[model samples]
Target: MFIKSFRPFAQSLRAPAAIILVATLAGCSTFSGFFGGSAKKPQPAELQPVVALVPARQVWSARIGEVTFPLQGNISGETLVVASNDGTVAALDTRTGRDRWRTSIGAPIAAGVGSDGKVAAVVTRANEVVALDNGREIWRQKLAAQAFTSPFVAGGRVFVLAADRSVNAFDGQTGKKLWAQQRPSEPLVLRQGGVMLAVGDTLVVGLAGRLTGLNPLNGSIRWEAPIASPRGVNDVERLVDLVGHVGRNGNTVCARAFQANIGCVDAQRGALLWTKPANAAQGVDSDERYVFGAEADGRVLALRRADGEPVWSTDLLRYRSLTSPLVVGRSIAIGDSAGLIHLLSREDGSPLNRLTTDGTSIAASPLLAGSTLIAVTRAGGVYGFAPE
Candidate 1:
């Protein structure tokens, strides 16, 4: 009776093995790419909410330097060094617009790179890198050709490059020659890493959209890796400012780039482990865990120290070439081009507090000094903003 009435059902499960096998197959249904079409409905895109900018605060205003070619802000010594296409380098007080000293670089200045440690480089149209001390000429070396890159000082070594493809390393204080080398001409023009970085025993050069490692001792090529920097842009001739000692890890030496890029290279081998484009690029300031690149597009990008990855980004362009972004007391504090100061969240781009500079364009980057926001403007303005 059971076999006749439930004949079909009994046959379907002829064996306990077959019953379990069918059940297993049913349980293996996939959510996508076959078995089952999809699970939940697709999520709809959401529009960003309109954000209201907090009011800007004003501090002080003064005309410190004149806008010569847009990207040339080569100020040095207590006097601000302002260069014009007219072959003049003006020295103004760092605090006041008052003139301190001025000299003719002998030719139309192509690059306005200088140092504050009691020296300034005066370049002629012919590519002469001269060492000047306290407004006086110390030593001048006629280069093989003209140079567009700035000078770098580190490990008691001051380095300058000539358009002729020569690299010269000299003693920072005495203006004596340490070593020199020539780079082979490549199809794509090569460039040095940045003027801002002066590490212990290494001098980094950015070339052919790559970072070249050089032994400061012998000026020899130590290693090479591709690190693309902004080549040519109106008002922005360069986008690489080779920043500081990227907390070294093992054989890898980490450093920040002016544009939204950073990398950790084998200090000895010069191999690239990882690279990520930062959302913003301007002046990068950082701590142990992150490196910050300031962007003209009005955003602050934070990258991880281990790998060049974006952790967070904050937009502050509305205020002006906002102050240099700083990592302080768990917050990123910066001043803006409009003379407004701000305290932003370090974890994510969020508004924290505010500071004001009555000055204008504080156009330069902020001095992220140990919880202090110091900035200057072309009008010879200075400010000291701190936490209460």
Candidate 2:
């Protein structure tokens, strides 16, 4: 049930029946596809040889657990914490891929492994927020709705977005209820990943294509910025949930609206800085100078962070289902459906190196740990690589 999708608007418009079928199936399985059940699986793109400008090789890999859906793994200090659908949560050494500790809470996990070194939080399929510390259960709190996004931990508080579109905060130490913010829920939303960004003292969440900044202490609205405006006659055409990860550095926070655009805003004031038309399903990643993203057509692009101006774009992996790009050292890394990690030049988007994972589709962004880049696959294989 791992969902990684980038359906075009044109294709969706021609298949209203498909949309209906997906909507019907969404309630039953908690995951849905706009192309319906009859849709064919896309074949992985064949990899052609590219000149390896920089030497890179796999450092270590391990089968951690099963990821039944597109999930997020958090790195706290040197420990990488990950969760599986079957309620398994494990803390692994980021450098050696060795297990630190593992535990199974005995319920289907719905989201998260958000940690702030001391505490780890995750949602259960039974609609509960479970908090753990040092591989032991600390506390659990029931939620009114299921969560589709990872719980975010910051400033001794745990924040999560419920499926009903409410933002709930809990004490990072005791799982005590803090404050909750509610928003109008969209009729149809992506059942997989959603955006939650912590900037300074504000908790920024993407709700129905709008970015709302909240005072994490009291759950009050600091400001609201619209990332995308809904359009067209049907709800299908107006589906613009902010998908995947949100990028933040200093006061600049950027996010991508599914099938729409990528935009940045001032985290301090919630003012729109700049935006560009981006037909991207995933979100963007940023370094000091550039914001990187992948388009639905499998094009990887880099834009200047200051003005949202396009710097470079490469269609070399077109139709390959590229993951969100992760900026590593001198190269940018992006995973594909074929389990290959393509490292491209950050200067020009040229292919630099290629590495393979466990032959399962990579649904999460590659994470940088010291000099090692860690990529997780759909079947829950963790692979670490470093430039040789």
Candidate 3:
């Protein structure tokens, strides 16, 4: 049944024709088998029983709505702000699992729940950027194109990275359009979230395969650094959009170019430190010493922070759909399609412990707030785990 449905897609890729826009593509996972050079879906490896090496327990759990979109949870101090595809947005206390506030945008959200504690922002499917102050609708502004990446709310402004390869900034309090910057559109873009964040006074964004640093006050290009370049025969093969949830330590920011390479940049200097080939769809996490990410084939890997050199690799979760990893103190916490969160030693990719949530795929990358590790599932179940 799967093969029959994908036959036309495979045939289309072989033909020398213009491919459909990225919005037409199902998702990052939809390109998995085809882009991984396999038409057959590989069976996930059976899990072996794990003896808990690190003590942890589920502290609490909550639900919003089934998260069907590319959702990224925003952590501000002790509050974890999240959104559902149905437009429900809420900020939950990480320590107590209590709602600080919850509200709906009255339209399905394409991406969002970016918050800076005071103001929360989300983009609706109708191409509108909505801002909420303490769960009350403040203002909304229309966008020129669809946005899959969450609106970055920081430094008293909301920034949106639209799929059309344009970046816009708005006044957080008034919704007034401040500035707009556009880049040449690419033939294809990932349906998933793209990178956009603040480093000091600079707004760093992923414009196609390049990490561009822009001045927030006025949308001027401060510097640009390429993590990957287009190099394949077709648009599908050449897609190199940068995924979100990058690793940042002080002035250095590391990110993964969709199925292309993983590299770090000196955001302060707007210089590319190094890039190494990495066929991963998700983003990466880092601590002081290592950068961690999972490949599409479900291999978890660690690379040195200074240089993109492989430190260790583990295939224990091979073929299982895995979310981007989160670095806890001594362990790396990552979730899989089966709703199981695996904690591995940061020193080596050895299993430290395993945790479980509602039996559904993890919707977003695992997040850490204070000492609590939060995992949101596709079923909209938000589970919080803490060291016991």
Candidate 4:
């Protein structure tokens, strides 16, 4: 379900004829399989053993609303901010999962619900950035083009990636344009989950399976490292894009590219630490010792964060498209297309627990709040679970 979201973005660009045909093939469910596409609706794994590595229970579950377009929920300090495509944004308490505030801005939200404790912002489908101050609309500014990624809020500035392959920065307080930076883009790009992470004073952006560190103050390129380069002759075989979440632990940042590889880099010096030939549909997450990722074939892998060596892997849920892994307590939690959340032991990758939410595939990755795990499904079901 998540991989299918990239089709619209590729369609917006003036791609080559071959690339356009492949993108259209990706959109058609029947034709996708002949091209070796893994985006099909796969059957979930049979009932597996629950090891009880950590006792957990669902704290609360609620039907927030419908999200016509896929968008990930954001985790603030004590609030969980989520938005629907129809422009309904809500802030929920982390512990109790109670609604703090929610309001409709009367516009179709295309980009985000990005917040920095005080202010929250979202991009409308009409190419406008809307800022909200404590649930009240503050200001709206027009953008150069439509944005599919989330608004990145940091250091009194809001950063977004437009459909034209440009990054625009605006003042968080007043919606004034700060600086805009453009990069050489492919004819096709992923429409969703292209993230920008703020590391100290620098900004790390994932563009076309390459990592570039930009000076947020002036939008200048500091360093570049390629996660995967264009290789195949046709554009479809060469469609390596940085997808899913980009995570950081201490000074190292890690990201995953579709049909490419997963790699970690030093956020300070932009040094490539390690790159592994892993074809994963989603990104990777880590604790202190190990990094965890979910593959398109329903295999979960664990690698040493220090050296990027394989630690363990499990294929207990093969063929079920899984969400990115989220580590909570001693278990690695991942949601599947069947709406089941599987918790595995962090030590040996053993099945710990399983959860279900609304019987719909989870579009957004799970968010960790304190010790609890908050996940939202495609059907707009929000669930909060914690150790018992």
Clashing pairs in 2: none
Q: Write the per-residue lDDT of candidate 4 for residues 204-279, one digit (tens) a residue.
A: 7777777888888779999988878888886556666666576577768777777678888887898988888887
Q: Candidate 2 at residue 227, lDDT?
A: 83
Write model 3 residue lDDT over 216-261, tens digit each, in one string: 8889999999999998797677777888778888888899988789
Lowest-sum lDDT 10-residue window in model 4: 8-17
Task: Please give the lDDT score for candidate 4.
Answer: 0.73
For candidate 4, give the lDDT of residue 352: 85
- What are the root-mean-square deviations of the candidates from the true structure over C-alphas? 23.3, 7.2, 9.4, 7.2
Q: Provide the overall lDDT of each model, using Cα atoms, as 2-decimal numbers.
A: 0.49, 0.76, 0.83, 0.73
Best prediction by lDDT = 3
Q: Residue 216 in candidate 2 has what lDDT?
A: 78
Q: Residue-wise lDDT of candidate 1 within 297-370, one digit each (tens)?
A: 46666777667778887544442444345555676656554555456666776776666555455444444333
In model 2, the worst 10-residue window by lDDT is 8-17
Q: Candidate 2, which segments miss by more than 4 Å at Cα?
A: 1-31, 36-45
- Winner by TM-score between candidate 3 and candidate 2: 3
Every model's TM-score: 0.60, 0.89, 0.91, 0.88
Q: What is the lDDT of residue 366 in candidate 3?
A: 84
